[model samples]
Target: MNAGHPIPGPASVLAGARVMPVLTIPSATMAAPLAEALVAGGARCAEVTFRTPDAEQALEAMAAHGGLTVGAGTVLTPGQVERAVAAGARFVVSPGFDEQVVSRCAELGIPVIPGVATATELMRALRAGLDTVKLFPAEPLGGLSTLRALAAPFPGTRFIPTGGIRAAHLAAYLADPSVLAVGGTWLATPAHLERGDYEEIRRLTAEAVARSTS
Candidate 1:
């Protein structure tokens, strides 16, 4: 949240991108190439999750690559929010809604997308002035049917469904007008990164992008 570098709004950040690849980098060294592969394959945004020790460094590398709009995901605390912003994260995403984390992001002037699985959580997010939220574990939550149900009560709200989402599910999810973008790990799995299979990553990304837009 550097004042000099303005952060885009959540909707703007996700504009035109139908899929946002969720990445878990095992090593920082692979960050640049991974980002390159995704961008080359037509991705406009990505999320680097904080589930690994190399997350911060990897985020820095991806942000510096100057292609995809990079965000920090799996953030659990305000302290992690600060660290993520310092590492050049343009946006922040958490698995669940946390007032403290959202407040901290607000203080830093960065867009935060917190996960919500129920109307209660969705209400809380809307009350806090956030209309865009992540629908965590979307598949287990009943996928598109559940999303339609949740969106029914809040027409103005938008969703970015994540967790257990795959390429096969992309078209169906994106078909819903309420869905802003779909996030998934299949585009850049840990195994893909471990094997340095950037080509496969690029192919998957391209395929998903094509399917989403088509």
Candidate 2:
């Protein structure tokens, strides 16, 4: 995180991106085209997960595309946070909460949405001045039922539920006022990228955008 360049708030980022496409790019070369396809389909933001060897390079490429606000996902360490910010990530998302990672992002002035599946973790995030968090493994944790339960006690807290979410689940998730957005890998599957099916990717993204808005 650079002291001179502050990232946008998570609320602002998610507000514009009701359907945040979570991407796992295999190579740097595919990043720009993927970004272009997503943007052409009306996506405002995306997350490049650090699950592949070229994750950072891919993130850099997507960020350079200049259309969608790109961020780093699956970030687990403070070191990865620094790398993600250097690669032009506007935000950082972790599969779970980490005090060190949160501190590092705060030090760099980057918005971070750490995952929380329990009230204890949610309390920790709230105490740290974070009102937004990701409800990880959302389906396995009980889907909208779980989301409603967690959000009941915290009126102003916002959530961005991710994991195992599909097109059919979008409407129900977004219908909750507590949800800032939804993150999913369905928009750009690995097969779509492997086959260089940018059109399919574009169509999926457009369909998601339509679902989120409608």
The global C-alpha lDDT for each of the candidates, from Candidate 1 onward, is 0.91, 0.91
Count of residue pairs whose backbone atoms collide, per candidate: 0, 0
Lowest-scoring 10 consecutive residues by lDDT in candidate 2? 1-10
Residue 211 displacement (Å), model 1? 1.0
Model 2: clashing residue pairs? Answer: none
Off by over 4 Å in 2: 1-8
Runs of candidate 1 exceeding 4 Å displacement: 1-8
Taking all chains together, each candidate's TM-score versus the true structure is: 0.95, 0.95
lDDT of 1 by residue, 59-83 (tens): 9999999998999999999999999
lDDT value for model 2:
0.91
